[model samples]
Target chain A: MRIERNGAIAALHGHCRVEDAETLAALLWEGSVTTLDLSGCDSLHGAVVQAILAFQPSVVGSPGDEFLKQHLVPALARRATAD
Target chain B: MIDELLAQFLIEGREQALEAGADLAALQRGPADPARLDRCFRAVHTLKGSADLLGLTPMGRVLHAAEDVLGRLRGGQGEGGDFSVLLEVADQVERWLDDLDTVGVLPESASAASQALIARLAGDGAAPQVAAADDWDGASAFPGRAGVAIRYRPRADGYFAGDDPIAIIKAVPDLAQLRVSLAEPVADPALYDPFRCTLVIEALSTAALPAVETALRLVRDQVALATLRAAEAFAPAGVEVETARRTLRIDAARVDQLADLSDQLVVAKGGLIELAAQAERGGDGQALGQALRAKQAELDRLVAALHTTVGQARMTPLAPLLGRFPRLVREIAATLGKPAALEIEGGEVEVDKAVVDGLFEPLLHLLRNALDHGVERPEARTAAGKPAQALVRLSARTVGDQAVIEVVDDGAGVDPARVRDRAVARGLIDATSAEAMSDAALVDLIFLPGFSTAETVSSVSGRGVGMDAVRAAVTRLGGRVEIDSRPGLGTTVRLALPIRMVLAKLLVVESAGERFGLPLDGVAEIARVPADRIFPIRAGRAFVLRDEVVPLVDLAQALGAEAGPSSDRVVVAGVGGEPVGFAVDAVVERIDAVVRPMAGLLAGARGVSGSTLTADGSVMLVLDLAELLA
Candidate 1:
């Protein structure tokens, strides 16, 4: 789900598609877009990962940003599950 | 192949039979006149013949059934009970006709119903001979045929009904060497129905028109019978005087064209005088044109008088629109379960034939609104110290070129405050705006789209659309809508519509050389203010116009045009009496012409309504006052 200040809103099925991630990156940089909601997305592709890392979003451990944090820290969850 | 045409003929025959039956049913209550009965019998008989000619057994069977019943009624053999049955048959047939009208085909389902009706009428068997007595026997006799020519249009249904139309023509008494022409038949027999009544008879009869009309008794609506004296047609031919007064009947469009020609010729007479004066002064052609100009002016007067008489001949009474309403009121009263009576006055008021067609929908909506909202329920009315029955009055009259139709009802009136409250609730207007609104301004809010004051929505009223829709429809035709309401009394919705909507007078004003028109009524006043006389205030601007302080807005900036130098003066205007001043570059010419609307994207633009051409043949934009004020 994505909600923008300029009245455009989009809902994704599950994980953000690679094409959708690139489009969101372009829209976010336009600055007119004030709101962003990306929940339930699992896989973060390499290009999208690099784009997100380059333009750092103020990510908090909120339900809406949970999916983004999960993709951000893959190793911690991998070790916890092994113990 | 013929079956489809037969079906078509049958459908039309059924429709004609039903219309005649309805007319008969309406005429039955009024003065018992033989002419009305004759009209009824003729419509049914025409349908019957058309059905038979098309060999539409089922359709012929039904019309034949109706014809027998109506024939007996016309002959005074049976009681009025048969009229009720015939009306039902007419209703069923009319329904079938409507289906055919919409889809171009009648469903097979109605055949059984038609058969049932035919069986009932068939059981009656023989029809009594109807009385053929004339109402006004020998009343205005048409003189001899020396200068006269007549034309007859045989019933459109006559050919399909197997009626030998030529025989009907031969039946006309004293008919002289008549030229007959058959109207072309429909092509594509597979799609064409042999039963469909497509035949017409165009005849030039020397007989008198009224006498022929008397002979035409049954098929009057379906027939175009006219008698033109030869002199009338020759009048516009620019021939000799006596020859111009001889007989010939021309179409109405040609008459209007002649009027335009005469007006142009009158102007040409002025030019002729100027030329003749110059010719005489130059000592040239004095003997050639001694009284030519005088003769031309006299000829112009004679032509003008002839044009006036011809135009008057085309003026038909408002009877047709008036005639349909009593029955409409009866039907609507039955449907709504209310005892409402329609009192129509001044129905003799004549209007352009075109205006009558546009009048129906607006009048219908007004009547429906009166029934649904204005008229109170029986018990409620009696409890409120009012009469149990509601009176719905429809009156039409000519006030100049405009016709004013007043639909007045004796019921509860609309409350302006309630309308204001609704506007506030809908968020259509701000709280401060609502508070500042005048009663007239508040009353005008009822015409806003999606505004309804009814407590509960019914199929008839509320539904978030009512008077506003009527206002929009009326205004689209270049008319004005006014509402007068007295709480606890009644509401009268007055529609002042012009005889024709094609042309109007617009006051042209300019802002930065770009011309725009403020519909004359929307412009309250236009004044010139010296650069020192005008003063401006913060937040909202006001200027004195005819002793009243009216708020002003710069037109160029308001319309989002590039800003230019400010002017001290402005055009103060508003719709529905909300005063707002719009500053323009200059006040230009006032023009009268046909307004042509802009297409697509341009039509939706703010502050611009439509465009029209000036006398100099230049386009001027019509300003949208409401949008500018908003």
Candidate 2:
């Protein structure tokens, strides 16, 4: 588990390919995240992505992966587009 | 191929065209606000472009003629000429489109309707009497239509279900834009398996809701679809620009999650509070305890801020619900031959979005009852020394933590005797029961199931359901509805509801060794007294509190729980303006809990409103104050 905090915002930095969803859900439940970051690291467990979708925190810094940045980030937060 | 494009326009073009349809409604009502006229004109311009593109001569001709009429209205033609002709042309165009939907082409008789409507819309002066009630101001009037955002994902086993995301997107009609992204994480090429489909497809379209829903009907369960107000669509329509604020639509579940997180903070704070009490007695870590207390205070501020920000997201103005009323009442008045005009105020009052959504149906029932049953006819009103046009005032305001919405009308009020006679005539109650019931109780009989006062069963409000459904719906939302009327004066229905139902603070009390949550707002006091202090009253025990005599009942007996040994602790709950005390075994600590109504069989149980959990994971029932007291 890789976690970084800037005030109330939280970002999962570096590689995180394997994670139990409940652990992340518990952590997210403990501390609310207004803006979540998904950059530098690319691999995400399927359940983690489900959690992120359910949480609906704004995604930032998507490591130049155009498909991820365009589709997943925009899907996560409708307002987090380049516009 | 040209036919296919027309089919696409039939769906997508018509959806886009509805954006300007309200301007036509506004045009018929009175002088067209310049901006509103422009909106209507612009809509036709876009539709004409698409129709011409599809080589549909009939659609193009109608739209072009309508555009000319809108252009004249924009150039100060002064709202005097017939605008209903344009509305008819638009409706005919829609009918032609609907024909295309079913038969794959326009109807054969479309040419005649097109010719007649085009000539009238172009001011050939064959104007008929305008219906006059067709007034809608576009988005400015009731623009609560939010854009539906959808995300689609095909599961690994989606192949078994015959679901393919690409084929689904390709099949979608009126797709404005589309994007496909990988649902897979970054991995080595060796482990990449394309056969296991994992892609999230995101799309935005101006297509109507039902069309998109039909397109994705096969795999709707595999995706997320949410209605959102697109931020960019607010193109500064230029009315009330100073107070405009851009909005982002978040799902209600997300806001509820934030509230849950905030609730977790409260639960954690409860533990910290207990620790602080321990440290204060120990004295060894007094300095550390003070520092922790200060940090807890800081945490309290941050959590509170989190709470308020999330709360604001769930709130919406009451105007949209209120705005739709004038148009509705107008139609009903014309139908019933009553000259009733509706006046709405305090449209700016902000309430929880859920509250606003749930409010419309109940208010509709009451307003229909008022119009069909309460309001007197024009001649009847004149004879009674009242205005010919009955005035129905629908207003809203915030009173403390509750929202008070009243539907007040000046007309013939409800007669309790008549209601009683109707109840007996309808066999809803026996004559003996009617004799024994008070006037107020007889009036309340209108809310009983299958009870309606409309003697002749009017065409408008004569749906078989009664006000009982209204009361049941409101009670489900933890709200109270009240009715009051004088013999000849008028009837007023007042509804009081909490701002939101998710989170509430309750004074924890124990009855018969079981914990119950008493809403803190309803609890005026918690008193500890000797058992000898209790005195017998006519039907129940009486306790003196603050120099006022209060009726007391055993909380355990009221809830039908096992009666344990009665203790000295009593929780005083407010009933209207009077005080009533509920005797319990003990008053525990206060808690902020998520008060949710019970589910399944427990839901039908009386006196128990809902259930919430303590931090220790024990389930506790929250008592219904009104039900228990009654």
Candidate 3:
């Protein structure tokens, strides 16, 4: 519910949870969402992190939470670069 | 220039490597636990993330492959071979980290090694099956957190059964650090069923175990609970946690600078004491000298405290060095077809970094000797009424100011008769001398150069370096090695090393109008032998000390200096286990000093180990008694 899709870009806001994973995955699977903006996000569930890992989405901006920005963001970004 | 981030990464990378390796070894030992597999996955994932950040593509590739295999194993679809491949990857990553530390770059062959390991891991991942589920008892995953740890793996059909796994965990009291992951790898997002629950959720709560258990009563069968004791919350699975101390990481060079400043302060304080002595000698300055002496006493106490603090700053725990031995022991045992286990104790004991760094090679050699020669074959062990599986214990403990490390094996011990015979055959000693030697003396011959009791040279240990090398390496660190063996029982090799290497007690002596220092530990006794008590020997002067003939060497002549005017003072020191007397002009006062090893042109200087600053700011050479005798 925290994800707003605009064409090829999906902007995530506030705290993202397990419920948001299915929608993110569906959008990623549809070959529409290529870039994710985590600028406003403060926390992420492990499932949401997994979705980003699997789809290898290009990430822009940064998370508000230090752990997410420093640890999770780099981990997620690495997958995209690796692909 | 070394990047601060890169240095931090190296420290963390080594820690994660050890963590992952230990977890993988545990997983390979018995029934599979998904939670344990998940812990291993996270450790590898962290390393890969850091490697990627540092642009270490080769290390990242290997870790990524390892993560995939662990994911599959967590999904109940992995074989036993996958664990070994992952362990190898962990070791390879550790070696790469070491290379990166020394050269600030990975080796050129890292890419090839990574590719080979990835291929092996991929091959092992091809054959998958349902792994048996075992209870996860490790509370180490929730480090520094005390409470009930909940590992909830909801049934795959639980979503249809109206069970919300996330809501169930969220209702627990004082929830903290919730982690969710796929119980199995998502094969394809296109075919993924969103409604089918395939998640493993783990969390910690401050609530009591019973309260948490009651909260998860509806899904009790799927949840595992464990109490994380507060005192040991930060320790690994088997390591004993010492009292927690707040620590800050500082560059080792900065610590050395602080120690050097402290040494200068000590010398200045010594100068003040000497000034007070001069003041007391003046006719009308007795009261002034008393006040000066009082201030000097206070300064002495302060300087002593500062020295102790600086010494503690240089202390590093032995865990980092000792952690890798268990895996090494396992691999060697497998290679030799000898089933053995290594139990390490007192790894938390802290010692000077120099001692810790210097101990690795000698300890590795001793461990190899234990595995290769001391431990008997499985059938041979059984025949001797011992357990089929050999146990090799590597333990460390602090006794007074020394760190005593022992590598012991529960197998056939050294046969002194065999050793004596080997010595005779090798021409190290004559048959008559060998027969006259006691069992203890014969066993000591193993430490002699070119000595090996193994009839055939094995690839594991007998590459020419033996216990003699171990002794030499330890001696360079100002430590000693002792060995004790029983005929049928096993052997114990003890390495008693000084906890602090910076500070030393030296006995100042004057010979030929020049002052020198002798290590106080080496000097057995000092006596004023009469001129008649000493007699001329074939090569040197001989004197009787406690009914034993001790050969005396003139200190000045030994150092190529002119003879001293007086030779009455005899300093008896035990070199190579025999008393040798050094004749000097006079024995000066003993003082605590820091000795810096000879460097530059004097690095290869014989008979002089190091130099220390005297109270008068003069460089006094600290003699190496063993080297002098040799």
Q: Which number leads on DockQ?
A: 3
Give the TM-score (vs. native) of candidate 2.
Answer: 0.37
Cα error, candidate 3, residue B257 (Å) = 16
Fnat by candidate, in order: 0.00, 0.00, 0.10
C-alpha lDDT values of all predictions: 0.57, 0.66, 0.75
Scored against the true structure, residue A27 in model 3 reaches a CA lDDT of 82
Q: Residues B1-630, candidate 2, lDDT per residue (tens digit)?
A: 455456546655565455554445445554546645654665576576566555567887888778766766666774454554565556556666777778876676667556745654544334321111112122222133334444666666654455545556555665544544556553543343334555566665466545676787777545444333333334323221121122345557668767776877777778777777867688568676686777688688768878777877777778867875675677678878998989899898877765775676577667777888889999999999999999999999999877889999887888999999989988999999899998778888887765778767564564433576567556645567888887789998888877766657788888887888999898888887567877999978897777888888888888777777978888888877678888898876675566878899989877778987654345789988778767
Which scores higher on lDDT, 2 or 3?
3
DockQ for every prediction shown: 0.00, 0.02, 0.12
Deviation (Å) of B540 in candidate 2: 41
Candidate 3 DockQ, CA atoms: 0.12
DockQ, structure candidate 1: 0.00
lDDT of 1 at B421: 91
Better of 1 and 2 by lDDT: 2
lDDT of 1 at B108: 75
Candidate 3 clash figure, as a count: 0
Better of 2 and 3 by DockQ: 3
| Model 2 interface CAPRI class | incorrect
Q: Model 1: runs farther than 4 Å from truth?
A: A1-83, B1-106, B110-284, B302-316, B500-630
